[model samples]
Target: MSFRLYWPLIVLLLVIPVIILVWQWRRRGRNVVMPFDHGQEGTGFWLRLLLNSAASLPALVLAVVILILSGPTRLKEPEVKRKLTNIEFCVDVSGSMTATMGEGDRYDASMQAIDEFLEARQGDAFGLTFFGNSVMHWVPITTDASAIRQSPPFMRPGRLPSQSFGGTEIGRALLACRKRLIDTESGDRMILLVSDGMSADLGGGRDIEVANKLKGDNIIVYAIHISTGEVPDAIINITSLTGGEAFAAGDVEGLKSIFASIDGMQQAEMERTAADAVDYYQPFAIVGLSLVGLSLVCSLGLRYTPW
Candidate 1:
């Protein structure tokens, strides 16, 4: 709780004394409350008492007014939203990924397919990586829904990161994905490797090292095999190595359905929500008012009574 206004400029005005009557200061009581004198007191005696109490009335009212003017407040927190999965789109940015297989080339169609998948999820964070000769992070593990919705169109042959001069380094792509996709502790963590079956060099025996590291993490790798050409043995082993599933993207419909299943992990209906709570400060003003009111009532009624 807090006070909205600490400075009481208007409070000073409350001290202006109310002139009840020209004779108010001069009033003197003739009656004495002796044991035998009570019966002789007149009605005017009670009237004097009421009139005297009136001196403190304005101050009491002023105090309540000040309290109302000062604002007091308190705070509230919001509930957490639904979270489902941490997904990574391991796009084959290799030179072959630009080969035209469907209406657009593999890369363009793959990006569009990823966009569709992202649309269905409410509670998922996704990352993008393009691997050809080297792996590049287009985006990192993020819940940036808008950015995910709008991926840059698949690169034209000339625009891609690097040329695919080397053999398919399938193991390298998987290694890169293994590193990115495993850290999101809860829900489902996965890597969807989309590529024309080609393996880039998975540097030496690091495949077993990475597989051993990811053994206990609930990470799954899904293979998106583009049926546009002959797939290599290394591309096929990605899902096998990680104990996950594989899908063939021979047609646009299959491509759509395959990615849809990946995105469905982010359903998160029970875990989705947005809320904001704020605090206010009004009680301090009231406390100040009560204090000032009590002081006035005591000062007025006790000293000025005329019974």
Candidate 2:
């Protein structure tokens, strides 16, 4: 609530009103030569003081006006807002994803976990990409969760087209997701990869290449393997390189827990915006208006007269 002036030097003009008010208070009374024989009495002390005060009202109003013209300002309160994060879900729709895990298959568990994740993260932008032998962008990066919520049934592994989409290409899917994430010009970028098996394409140094590219573009990769087997080394490498972790979830509950862990690890950031400067003329304006009203009232009787 501190006050500041845009043009501080203009405050020097206050000297004019100060001098006028001081002179009005300090000047002595003059004698009036009346035609009629009246007593040689002077104005009473309280009456003289009241007259000086009434005369000083205009000077006080002028001072307030000067202050308003100086452009007074105060800092507005700071605001807290959630920092946006763009998350792309790269889910494998290969044939192996149809294998059973808990009550449903790996694909079902993954989709359910994703639904829960979307519910937990209400303010983030999400994109959905189904990857097998090829990649399909089912949903674009957006704040709307309805599209992502209604997407699982359509991209189920069993419902995907013939054997053309049977192979798992983790590196290719990651690269595709990275392309979509990089196009987004704002927010923290992340890729959540869900798969049940290893990809032949990610072996040797292809995983490193993809990881470096994602890292260069500031995209983090969090991998979730919904299988009893260990998570692939390539997946671990990519996630680790991009400042993320890989988790293996054997059942539906573990898959949900894994998504929750990812949520905990990549929590939404809180940002505090700098306070803005706003005009602070209300007090001065009120004072000026009051003085104006007082001056108008005093004009009827308390003003100085030549008589």
Against the unseen true structure, what C-alpha lDDT does each candidate score? 0.63, 0.89
**The CA-based lDDT of model 1 is what?**
0.63
- What lDDT tens digits, residue by residue, belong to model 1 across residues 53-95? 6545554555556545554444455566665678888776666
Residue 291's lDDT in candidate 2: 97
All candidates' TM-scores?
Answer: 0.57, 0.77
Q: State which candidate has the highest lDDT.
A: 2
Q: How many backbone clashes does every candidate have?
A: 20, 0
| Residues forming the 10-long window of minimal summed lDDT in candidate 1 | 13-22
Model 1 misplaced stretches (Cα beyond 4 Å): 1-78, 145-154, 157-166, 180-189, 200-209, 215-218, 228-244, 266-277, 280-307
Evaluate residue 160 in candidate 1 and report its C-alpha lDDT on the 0 to 100 scale.
Answer: 60
Candidate 2: tens digits of C-alpha lDDT, residues 75-122: 889999899999999999999999988788888889888999999999
